[model samples]
Target chain A: MSSEGTQPLGRARPQETPAVAAPLLRRGMGNLATVAAHLVLMTWTVFVAFPFLWMVVTSFKTDQEIFFSPWRLPSALRWENFARAWTDASIGRYFLNSLIVVTGAMVLTLLCASMTAYALARFDFPGNRILYYCFLAGLMFPVFLALVPLFFVVRDLHLVGTFQGLIIVYTAYSLPFSIFFLHGFFRSLPGEVAEAAIVDGASPYRVFFDVMLPMAQPGLVAVGIFNFLGQWNQFILPLILMPNPDRYVLSQGLAFLAIQRGYESDWSALFAGLTITMLPTLIVYVFFQRRVQQGLTVGALKG
Target chain B: MHHHKYRLIIPFVLPSALIYGVFVLWPYAQALYFSLTRWRGFSRNRPFVGLDNFERMLDDRLFWNALEHNALMLVVLPSATVALSLLFSALIAQGGRGLRGAEIYRIVSFFPQVMSAVVIGVLWSFVFHPNIGVLNGFLRVIGLGSLQRTWLGDPQWVLWAIALVAVWSSVGFFMILFIAGMQSIPTDLYDAATVDGASRWRAFFGITLPLLRDHLQVAFVFMGLSALDLFALVQVMAENGGPSRAADVIARYMYDLAFNKSQFGYATAIGVVLLILSLVLSVLVVQLTQRERIEF
Candidate 1:
């Protein structure tokens, strides 16, 4: 929710009065428009949702049935396809590894981003503008630009092929956008609240934790969900950093199911693997859809 | 209070500053330094190659080709995607209220956003497969047989093919931003136009276009950066930017130089060039799109 008493809040909600007493010709035209809209929406929706639906359906069909009738729904639902995908492909282990990597990255990114955002927002220190611009520049710098040197840096620190290494890279990758989003939210907070707390003999730490942090909760949730989704679905960094089979995250592991040799092109198994991999992100999105959308739009438009 | 404020800023800022410095700032500085030296990665002694790497980059045909492809993408992908998304947003906006269909469209369009680029790349590869592929299959049924071509395998069409998929994947997300921007434009303007006997097209050009300028600029910047940094689809669709390096963006080029070729110094030079290009473009975009603050 936006801050209360900021503007005439009625602007947030569109009026919903139903139109009545339209002429017959106008009504007919309106009905035709509505039908056209639905037709267009449905056609595009099917196009968009087809791969996801196909992935689900293919995951259930037998391998023989996959190639024979790739488009047809399975005659019998085979839940065992998922079981095989989970066990034979070591997806379960990959899930845990991904969980570890995402969790570590999210925790560290949030902690650091929040502290950084709070400082930049609330304090008028020297070099504040310079510091803010530095973070903004990070947003524009493509991560690929850093890959060659980062590989050497990670190697020098002896962190390659480790969960810690992936976390560090992910955290560093995510910090710029995270800090950017949090900084906007913190800036929007009225300074009076923090000032009042400081005047009440509260230290900056106490004021940040006890006052500003609570106010910045929605922003934090937004940034956290964005980072979590990003880290969870990440393929590139894991592909390069975690070359060991044991260290593969879910995204890489699931992709391996589709690409690995010696395995028959089991469409069902690949679909099952993809479905399992996509579940966590889907759940997060469903729960915090609004915040995620807001975060994305704000991050883009504001930056 | 002032003294306490300085103390608070110190503790609050220190931790993040340290982490960011170590992981980001330091590594970036090192990347710049490495760009000037020929380090064989594992070798302890890195020869200071000076501008040799930069000079080589000037002559590297692949680098220029990749830059051309990136420029083409910057022109083609963002404009097409954003324009299409804006059109869709305007259509949906005009469809009036009680429209659950709009919600469905939003969800379906954004589904691709949730899927990883790798998965999308793999899935679309099958869709565009020449023989058993869906697109060709449809073309055959429609009697447009000659239009069927090997989308990814071809050197010429690979970039366009990949760009089409990228647009398809991203249009929904941008549409959402456009819709939000549309909503922010007060409906009274539309009402006023209607009362003045304005056509839908007239209202759109007069009211919608002007108000949506800020959102459009933002979408442009985001899509431009994303297009410039394209790698996942390039990696999956063509495996190595296809034959003759057709779909190679700067990111994939950087990856190949570092990981595939072990050309550390050359790769860093390429990376530095990309960084500079992105920075310059981003600044230009910001300057062009900067909106005067509106006091309501």
Candidate 2:
């Protein structure tokens, strides 16, 4: 190949021109490879999508059809399964409980993590590095290590089985990662902006809330999404803390449905219940795919 | 002015510190104290037993077994995930026009990351059922019927099955990390490599891997820590880590000791051991991945 003709294929620059050489024979092979790539990707996508599709299909099937022929598509849609799951399984009460706990946790996590990150980013104080490392150490501590003792602490405080108590625990658990991510974003901001505000005689609090917080909206949204998804799907903590059936979150309630076994393997209702629990996360993920991906990338790579 | 600065910092910092201290740090200290005593989770008073819990843990074969499984997972899952992610990122990064479709694949792969481990466990359980399961059905249709096995039911395969799911769920997150690292590398480096007549593989080893060291280290540490926190999957998939604790990991074993057996002191001992192991592993990883900062 001539130097000019081969440059695009050989070079790794962003401005390289697209290669458009070769006769019909080479072009046919290229087309075939492209087709094969798409075929492979589509097959794997179906594999990933199957379980979710199965759950949705079975949720609409009759109880009789659930066991004998789980593979078959439902002949008639059964919408009442959702209603029965909501009432009989007490999912409505669980939904409300989850909402309260998640909302409270989200607010607490945002306030504490944001303020701590801002302070850490802007100020040069004694024990600053040590404090930051302490937070990082928290990230490495396994959640199960805290479980045995947290039970006692919560019980002693008489917060057990209370929404506010669970919210407290959730907030504490989420703080480390939230502060870590937000601290990175805060560090990336121009130092001159805060310096300028300081020179204007603006108090640190005003500079933080009035100026910096708005600039960190993307970080806030990212951390908020993480906290929401995490708190919503939290199972073990709520399972241990909230023993009262009336206060079950969606995950704990769905798990209870599976464990009862009295339903004689009523896979339809079980699938319906799981689908209800999973829908909100799946919807949020589909809508904010870019942000979620960006968040995960930033959180992992930057740290 | 300095005192005022201290005042500003303390007010903002104290609430979080106090809550975290009382809730997390204090309880951990309490766990250490309780491990030396035999408290049945509730009593008016309990007596100190002094090293009895640690001794019991040393002799407990199941504890050793669980630790072994956790070590295996820590080695297998993160390394495989990082390797696969690096490969995928390289391919996508090189295939400029094809990157759009690759983005969609990345999104689908990441769907599993947001899912609860319980849900993934349940879904995979059905797929791996001994009979009428999709996996076996597909195998039979493809004339690989002899290779099909009961994935979760068998003791030998259960840990592998669980580990496979963990690795699959994690690859997307790490893939995104590798992509980000790739994006940050200046395009000029690759051009210089091409000009030097370096093959793609050579260029990757020389240019991409060294520059991506920081990102790889971070991913490894995070994934390693995550593998140590393996509770929900074992709880849902194997329901007490299988028929005879064959799929047991440290976290699940700790849960069983604390909740099911109600051996509070023994469970606290196990928790202490887990904490130490995680700390040591994280420190070693950080040390091994440490490098003199590249000025570039």
Candidate 3:
């Protein structure tokens, strides 16, 4: 207990702290509870890992192998499954579409949201509190609440079924959270830099853009990660706003392919398509997981 | 400074404010009005029918069916997710320092949460694919062939199946949350409890659980709201609520009405109902979970 946070991570190098290890193991249910904890942990690891491993293995199997040898690895790496998924199943198109929409939306969200957040944080205008809370209010209800009319609004703007339409919609909905998170961040930033820049006769916009925005880089990154993942994985907005089959985002495209699995049972290609849809998110999570957890946990605890 | 404030403020705020208003806020206000009318597709003529959609919900069988499922979710999803996460978190931080690789477990378990819900749904459909599914295949190998059933296709199992996936995808996120909470509780409290002859069970339920109430509140509200808005999963697993409408939920009912059926007014009404349910759920969690703060 005394060496609490100093527990060396990774493999138990109990040799480094033999004194610490012995009493810790001996104190609780002695060896039994540790064994039970390991059992629970192992069972969960298997549960989470099994489906993914199975999916990865199954993606390479031929239709025949998929049905007969469900447990077996594919006899060969059937790269055609990935090829068919990418080309024929239109997963490649969907992946590109998701990239465009998410990239555009994330940039727009950070730009507009950070500007708005900086205003709320740095200035004390007449309706500052009102505007701040107004933005935060979007966090309370689920985004789907506006779905029925949101379509009509998009259609009215003649932006329906386009990347710009979906991008703006994603940016709009993401505002509440981006603003909320960045507002806290911008508010907490040291005011000395901004004050110093202003006193040098720097224009207010100059102070914000050249001075303040760069200072808010850490906040921007956190918000960027949260919104990038959110906007990328967004399903309903794209499902509703971008109704054209050719322009469907990844999640919506996968659903289309899944449902279409009935008419054409290309099980391998379907699995490959699902894996394709999951790849970028997997890569992002693998690298930026610590940041992802921190940013999102703050959102969860607050929102 | 005061004279120049509005220059930065108005420009900084107005564009996003305008976009947010038109796209998000305006639609929210417009939905309430649309709900009270008989607004339909591509129509120039529309009659304002006060309370008609809401009243129709009283007699709508599908409405009740969907509401019942969501009500069931309101009860089931949060409890299952919270219980598993709490247990996992407690284990991760047990006695201040948990077993080796607890941190790694926390890290890997979170992968599913970051995956798009559509991917999870489509992936699990393969897993529940009856003959080719791993679930059934494992059952056969384990000599439990008779126990296998078409999970998503079974009316009795469909809702629970989706809920189970929902819990599985989410439990890790909450585990990380609770682990943070547990690790923050001073080790001295546990030491004090042990010295007072409190068993681990008593110490956990009494000291650990009580101290983690705020985290519990966050977990419940989030889990409850998600349960209420289980639109993505339900749409993926059972677009029209699955077999015999066994798995229909309010959010899906709303989406189906608006998108497929094009009964925009009635669908918007349903959306309003979903909104009200979520608000009530949040308020209820706050009221119910409120406790006196114990300063350490």
Best by lDDT: 3
Q: Indicate which candidate wins on DockQ.
A: 3
Q: Over the stretch B153-206, how does candidate 1's per-residue lDDT look in tens digits? A: 889788888998899899888877776666666656766776687777787777
Q: Which residue ranges in model 2 land beyond 4 Å of their true spot?
A: A1-43, A123-133, A184-207, A261-263, B1-10, B44-46, B130-132, B137-150, B290-296
Error of 1 at B103 (Å): 1.2
**Model 2, A213-245: lDDT tens per residue?**
999998899999888878888988997799888
Order by DockQ, highest first: 3, 1, 2
Order the candidate numbers by lDDT, best to worst.
3, 1, 2
In the range A1-303, model 1's lDDT, one tens digit per residue, is: 122211222231222311211111132337766677678767777888876676677678887776566556789999988887788778788999999999999998998899888889867889998988887777766776677667777778898899999998899888888887788789999989888987898877888889988999988987887788788879878877888998899878766765672146655666677778778777877776656666665656655
Write down the C-alpha DockQ for each prediction: 0.38, 0.31, 0.50
Docking class of 3: medium
Candidate 1, position A146, lDDT? 72
Residue pairs in steric clash, candidate 1? Answer: none
- Note the residue pairs that clash in candidate 2: none
Q: Cα lDDT of model 3 overall?
A: 0.83
RMSD to native, candidate 3: 3.9
lDDT of predicted model 2: 0.75
**What is model 1's DockQ versus the real complex?**
0.38
DockQ of candidate 2 compared with the true complex? 0.31
Q: After superposition, how far is residue B7 of candidate 2 from its true place, in Å?
A: 6.4
Candidate 3 lDDT over B174-249, as tens digits, reads 8877766665566667667766887778878888787777788888999998888888888888858899999999
Q: Against the true structure, whose TM-score is highest?
A: 3
